[model samples]
Target: MSLLESWDRGEHTAETLRGTTATYATYRKGSGPGVVVIHEIPGLTPDVIAFGEEVVAAGFTVVMPHLFGRPEAGLSPLAVAGAMRQVCVSREFTKLATGETSPVAGWLRSLARELHTELGGPGVGALGMCFTGGFALAMMVDESVAAPVLCQPSVPFVPGRRRGADLNLSPADLGVVRERAAAGCQVLGLQYAGDPLTGTRFDTLAGEIGDAFLRVDLPGRRHSTVTTHRQQEAVDRVLAFFTERLS
Candidate 1:
C-alpha cells in the first residue's frame, strides 16, 4: 500500500500546530521520551511521515514538523519540487527563507523546546534529513536535545564553497555545537555511499565533532532511497539509537 493510504486509515494522527497552523502527522506509542522528525527538501511527504510512525511504534512520541508551512501544504514530492524551484528562482525569496532570521535551525529549536516542556516534558531527540540534517547538531546548543540523527544531510552541498555558503553553518555556530558535543551529547549521522552532496565532506565534519559522532554508511544507497525505499531500516536504526541514548 502507498504510504498515504496508511496515513489516512487512522494509523497516525493528522494534526496542526497551534502557532504555525501547519499540518503534520504525529504518531505516539512508547512513553519514555520525545522526538522531533525534520522533513526533507520535499517537505513532510508520505515516507517521512511513515518513518515518524515507525519511531512511535518503537516507543516514543514523535513530532514531524511541517517545514514548508501553509502555502504548499500537503503537497507531493513533485509539487514541492516545483514550488521550491520557484522559491529558488526568485533570489529574494531564497535568501529570505535561508537567511539567519528564518533559518532552518532556529525553527527546529522552537520545536525542540516545545517538545521538551509542552508535549512530553521528558527531553527530546531530533532527526533531520537531506537539507535539514545539520539541524540536529545545531540544536544541541540547547541542552534539551538528547539525541540527534542526520540522514544524508544535504546542506553544505558543495565542497570549498562550504565556508561562506548559504547552507553552511558559520564557524562560530559550529563552535557552539562542538562545545555541546564536548559535554557528551551523542550525534548520529547517515549518508549514502555515492551521493556527492553529502558524501565525504559530511564525514569530515562529523569527525571534527569528535567521539559523540556516530556515522552510518549505507552501501549502494542513494539520497532519495535512503528516505523512500529503505525507510524501515532507517527508522529501526533511528529508534534504536534514540532509545539507547534517551532512555
Candidate 2:
C-alpha cells in the first residue's frame, strides 16, 4: 500500500511530551509494550507515520515524536531539504560532532521512561531512522530501553574516517551502551551496503557491541530501510526483533 493509504488507516492520538530540554508533539497508538519511533531528517512524513502504524499493528504501543518537520507532510525534495536545513542548524542535534550524543537523546529517553512506566512493560523499544537513527542506541544508556533499532544511522556526518567509525555517542554514553550490550541487550541495525550516509559505522557497531549487534545490511545504496527504500525483508526482521525483545 502507499504511505498515504496506510497513514489514513492509522488511528493515532496527538499528544505532547514535556522533556527537561524540549517539549515534543507526538502521535500515539496501539497497546502493550511501548516503542518510540523517531523520524528521519525529513520529519514525521507520511512514510514515517506508516512505519509507525506497522509497529502498532505488531502489538506494541507506538509513540512517534515530531523531532523536526511538519507532521503528515508527504515526501518531496523541497520538504526534505527544508528539514535537513533545520536539522543541520538545530542546537538539539549534534550533526557533525563525533563521539557525542545529540542533546535530544536525553529528551527521548525521558519519553521512553514515561511510556514504559505507564504502559507497564519489562522495558520499552526504540526505532530511529536516518538522522535520528543513533538516537536509539544512545537511549540504551538507560536500562529501560530494551529493544533499540537503528536504520541507516547517518550522523556525525562522516566527513572523515574517525567520524565514520564513531557511533555518534559520547565516550561516557558509549561505555554504558557497551556495558548494556555485554549484559545481553541486543541492538539491530539496518542499512544498504553502498549507502555513504551510513558510513562504516556498522563496522564500529560490530566492533563495539560485539555479538549483540545484529546487522541487516542490504545490497546497493538504498538509504531508508523501512520507509523511502522500503525493504520488506528489513521490515519483517524488525518486527521479529521487536517481538523477540519486547514481547
| TM-score against truth, every candidate | 0.74, 0.91
| Range of the 10 consecutive residues with the lowest summed lDDT in candidate 2 | 9-18
Each model's lDDT comes to 0.61, 0.85
Report the C-alpha lDDT of model 1 over 90-145, residue by residue, as the tens digit. Answer: 32122322223124455466567767886554369998777667677667766788
TM-score, candidate 1, is 0.74
Q: What is the C-alpha RMSD of each candidate to the true structure, in Å?
A: 5.7, 3.7
Once fitted onto the true fold, the runs of candidate 2 whose alpha carbons sit more than 4 angstroms away are 1-20
Best by TM-score: 2
Q: What is the lDDT of candidate 2?
A: 0.85
